[model samples]
Target: MKFSQSIFLPIAAIALTLSSASFADNNQRRIDIDSKVVTEHKAKINNQRFSYTVATGTQPVWDDKGDAIATLQYTYYTRDKVDDRAKRPLLISFNGGPGSASVWMHLAYTGPRVLKIDDEGYPIQPYGVKDNPYSVLDIADIVYVNPVNTGYSRVVEDKDGKLLSKAEQKEQFFGVKADIKYLAEWLNTFVNRNERWRSPKFLIGESYGTTRVSGLAHELQNSQWMYINGVVLVSPTDIGIKRDGPIKAANRLPYFAATAWYHKALNANLQAKDLDELLPEVEQFTINELIPALAKGGFIADDEKRRIIKKMAQYAGLSETFVEQNNLDIPTQFFWKELLRDRGQMVGRLDSRYLGIDKRDAGESPDYWAELTSWLHSFTPAINHYLREELNYKTDIKYNLFGNVHPWDRSGNNTGENLRLAMAQNPYLKVMIQSGYYDGATNYFDAKYTLWQLDPSGKMQDRLSFKGYRSGHMMYLRHADLESSNTDLREFIKAALPKEGQAAKY
Candidate 1:
């Protein structure tokens, strides 16, 4: 799961309401009999005003296993300003975690408004958010959705609640495939209801949501009929969790080192200015250097082993002796715990921006990352205000945007297999990836490593490009960094569109 979600931006004003609870005289359906304003909120950023709406789900969405949930949504719309039907793209976006809502992305990127971030990396303490003049809403119609159980999107039930199934439940919708599949169906229904069927469509997902899009791209193609032209994956990680089988996993150590180096926590030096440049070196070293050394084991000649280990030590930014001590295999969790361990500090496994020291000599990891604290409760109001006051959707339940992973229900995957499926089906579809140097969870290395996994033609590979920034997973919280990402994303979007001679403009 992501450490936090992007913020949910609303288009205009804010108001929330709750109706009288009324059941359909059955356990399956619970409808509120009456409705009234429950709450309202708003934000103004960069001289623009954004609003949100909050409501409860009057009807139960499910009752399989988990808890009965409800739903809440944030919407943004631009009428005349949006590109005409010929050019407009209706982009639906969300974060992963199957448990997370759209807050992090909404607050950080894509939304018409953004929550200001403090130097330590979180929405400001006074709780102020504002309109984003840089918002892509000027070009496309966008909505940040929280799934059935994450954010305020929930399901309320009488028997066992609307939720069904649990972890490793790969066969149930509660997992990966089901959540996205349902979203697709619901979205299709929503579009048909709203008359947006003709608009071009796009999906922007981060982390697990990247995995979600990998499948959604295919689903939208084969069954959904919402043909998509572009997908922007921010730090993808849908391949089988273990990478290579368990035993050979040690061979991929350079990736962890590269991740550490990007965070500036590693001492090893390779001649590359940033992650984008260093990736090739790491990939090469992993093949020509580290892989060979690992194969030799203790039987390898001493000088050759020494040469590789020294390079490894420098590349990994760990003490040469320490590298030798561990036999060149530093586990991911250990690296996370050790990089700053000596200083009695630890960097977050989720978002590297959070740094903490062990409170005791026992070397315990911090209770939570700094950003996690901000995600705890700050986003509810943002969604609430956006829903009722602006786009004016009505409901009466909490939106469950984040929840436990129910694999049984997951639609497809973020694996190399699925990405290729999407690309192969839509040869012209373009992929753009953005990574954050400080994102240890879905490190940039993982995305770069996927090059070998994909079987696309050389031309397709050539068309793929990636960008890495100095910030963490939700990097946009950093204003200047956001401007840089925005500029590049906009340029890429223009080039990928159907236009033949359009200049890449932001």
Candidate 2:
């Protein structure tokens, strides 16, 4: 689902020992239903097919006496052959937006395979296609969950035939706490039915999904809290950052600047040096130098801090005076223009994967996320086609890979550090953060910056690993980067999984 303006929105596959498989032909273009209410999806792609299901369950909205009111749908994907004895790693994946679906991650990064983008790295194909050997399905079973009201998932209505409206959905499902509670119950049942209770469970969330995982980790710990092996957070958000506070707006500045330097069309000295080093300095400069300049709240000291502003402006690849004019508090929009204006272009705010040459200064909130969208549109259909024809599944509704995520719950009021508190309570729950160096939406540096600010008091650095890739947020879209990320994920999974012989004994 799209988060900001047009910029946002943000899979797992089962394993197949075989390199290639045949599509189901006539049987392929379909979905399998466990019941009238629950439907499963299976796709065959790249001649190396995988499968998944969209199963539905209900969560009680009140005390035990009442009928269950919420219908929750989660997408489950696993290896073709799951070893009963092997405590296979299970990752419950979710996207951001609070209102987002699991499609982006499912189709792009964590799924068994990926859709190919064009050379400019936008989602277009000569209709070109490729295999994602780096797909994590080899090591872990991935579940891309579309929280109710997203993707094909939705709410449970009264037998009286009540349909859910946008307002009703928000009233029922938009909040994080209730969503996680329902998900925990739903997952518990799904696991029991599938007999996957022995698996080592993990959660991988991007952007706001990261927020969901954090809280759910604790909710699972305290409420339905079970044994969770680990969590992989991509581009996380701190409640403290999202909430109204002295830090919310402050934390975003560095992120904008960090992304600005990487948007080559913007940075005048794009060829200057390795951006990896320069970005952190920009982050540090924003926090250590520029933030205080803004916080000073006085004309005289503010003037003196021009030196700091000069540094920030310089590091951001923007004019020093621009920083002065905005008093080092430039909003994210300005960065897009200031960095690229010289080239008669404006970088994007969404994925930061595109460049838009804008001649006018003002317009509606511009979503330059086409860099990401264009890449997936061309190939997602092919992948979906393969899933049905080659893999064993059936469906009536057409699989919606990705689309407009509107009326989202951007008013994030999820406070109560229970998520972090639970994480601290369960020292066993580890986290791995994978970030794209160039992603502007949830900048990698911002991810780290917010993490440090949260101060996970448990000294859990070993449990939390952050890896940087050369591409944008969906690093897997790039063949080379996905391979490396796959290797890293495999290692991570290996560490979390039960050792070979320890299966039943554990």
- In angstroms, the error of model 1 at 263 is 6.6
Tens digit per residue, CA lDDT, model 2, 432-494: 778776666776766776556454464656666778776666666666676777677777877
RMSD of 1: 6.9
| Strongest candidate by TM-score | 2
How displaced is residue 83 in candidate 2, in Å? 4.2
Error of 1 at 402 (Å): 3.4
For candidate 2, give the lDDT of residue 66: 47
How accurate locally, in lDDT, is each candidate? 0.58, 0.58
Residue 243 shift from truth in candidate 2, angstroms: 7.7
Q: Give residue 90's lDDT in candidate 1 (0 to 100).
A: 71
Worst 10 residues of 2 by lDDT: 1-10
